[model samples]
Target: MLATTRNTLIQLAEIQHQLQTIHEFFNKWQTNPWGFKEEYLSEKVLVRFLKYETESFANREWEAHRKEIDLHIILQGSERIYLEDATKLTEGIYHEKEDYYLLEGPSNHFITLSSAIDQENSLFLWPTEAHKTGVNVTDEAVMVKKMVFKIKY
Candidate 1:
């Protein structure tokens, strides 16, 4: 799923960083698994794998990026991702080299991401769109394996 209310330059970001390497991984995820390794697809594209159990909203933190557009692909299990506009959230300390800052606010909008549940199976989050991921979809916690493609813009 994609949210655009936070920033209208989302289209520009996508066009500049076409996400070509990400598509390659999409086709070879099963045949050529990269495991849980951090790989640099190119100078502009990067690959990261994460395995964790979904936790409560309060336990997680909201974050927004300034340099890259995040493409979250769920490989196994399910998670609820909450999104909020950065303009409305209170900003915390930012990691300069990392290009991200913590956000604190309420988010009433979200989507459930899972291999079996979502038809798209992937989600795109651009700059200024604060997101709190790894959220539990139900009452119980479930382990999720996800691949994140950081498309620099």
Candidate 2:
């Protein structure tokens, strides 16, 4: 997460530099069975493997950890992420087993993201942003590369 605009700019530049390295790594490992792994600028920046199954979606209840700036990079397949407006969120019965609270459905705002491999390297999500992920309509599974950073207010 970026603490300020300046930090966001810095992170963006560093991410751009790392994108070149990531592309090379992807070229080699895109078809590899072992997959790939790497560390970014610092421990605060991370690269990890992500897979989303077809017709599967994750309903999540998230609260701010300070503030968050997420860089979701798709490395393989495709999935739709449903985001709910924070202002519209209302408390629901806690399901301790799931480790997250459920929000009343019939959301007022949402967005769909398709395959974005050749277009851009990163997408940003802010704090208090309620999001439901892994909505895939395709038969093929989707792989994504994500870097989650904490933004200090």
Candidate 3:
């Protein structure tokens, strides 16, 4: 898993290049809803712009993908994301269409992200990493808008 910001992007050309199309996509959808056509980034990449109320960490499940990497960028609010080694978790059957596997048990650690930090605050999870997102940082549930870029691996 990789946690970074826009400030560090210039130094990560190899990774940033994979996300180049998102910059224009963000600009074009500033006022648009979360929905978009499947595979917006390219033939294999799927971009999901989602907005939802933050939930308790206990309510979220740890999920890992087999063929895609998860790129999470917080655009509107704050949330804590928990990550764990997929190999350590009890895995459920993989969902081919969604490209993710359901994992049981807690995570090894977590990180928090918010829009105030920077528009580029992002987290990338590889196929071996399981993560639980949408957990609130504070006591109250806040609405969070985040973009999930599913890049084919």
Candidate 4:
């Protein structure tokens, strides 16, 4: 997993394609319909935009993809995302259509994201990284608009 900001994107010039795709998505997807849907960025990368109310960690399930890397970003509101090593968690059934495995265990760590500020915290979670997202940052549930870019691994 890696967390970074928009300013650091240029420094990763070696990964030109991926970086550019992310930048384009960041600019183009800020507005439009705020809901659960997929937008193709390229042949190998797609953006899944979601907007919903945050929930408690207990209600969130750990999930990991088998063939894609998830790049998560918050476009509106705030939420916490829990992440941990998928291999360390109890194995669960893999959903082929979704390309993810359900896991059960304690999250090792978490990161909070807020769109009101210019923090622009972007996280990349590889297939080996299991994560439970859309978690509330505080005791009360708040709505959050998030985008997950699915890139080929």
Clashes of 3: 0
lDDT of 3 at 18: 64
- Worst ten-residue run, lDDT, model 1? 1-10
Instruction: Give candidate 1 misplaced runs (Cα > 4 Å).
Output: 1-17, 117-120
Per-residue lDDT of model 1, residues 46-138, tens digit only: 888889999999999999998888989998899999999888999998897887899999989998898785355678887888999999989
* Ten contiguous residues minimizing lDDT sum, candidate 4: 7-16
Model 1, total clashes? 0
Evaluate all candidate structures by whole-model CA lDDT and list the values in order: 0.84, 0.50, 0.79, 0.81
What lDDT score goes with residue 143 in model 1?
94
Tell me the lDDT of candidate 4.
Answer: 0.81
| Cα TM-score of candidate 3 | 0.79
Pick the TM-score winner: 1
How do these models rank on lDDT, best leading?
1, 4, 3, 2
Top lDDT model? 1
On the 0 to 100 scale, the lDDT of residue 74 in model 2 is 57
Worst lDDT run of 10 residues, candidate 3, spans 8-17
Better TM-score candidate (1, 3): 1
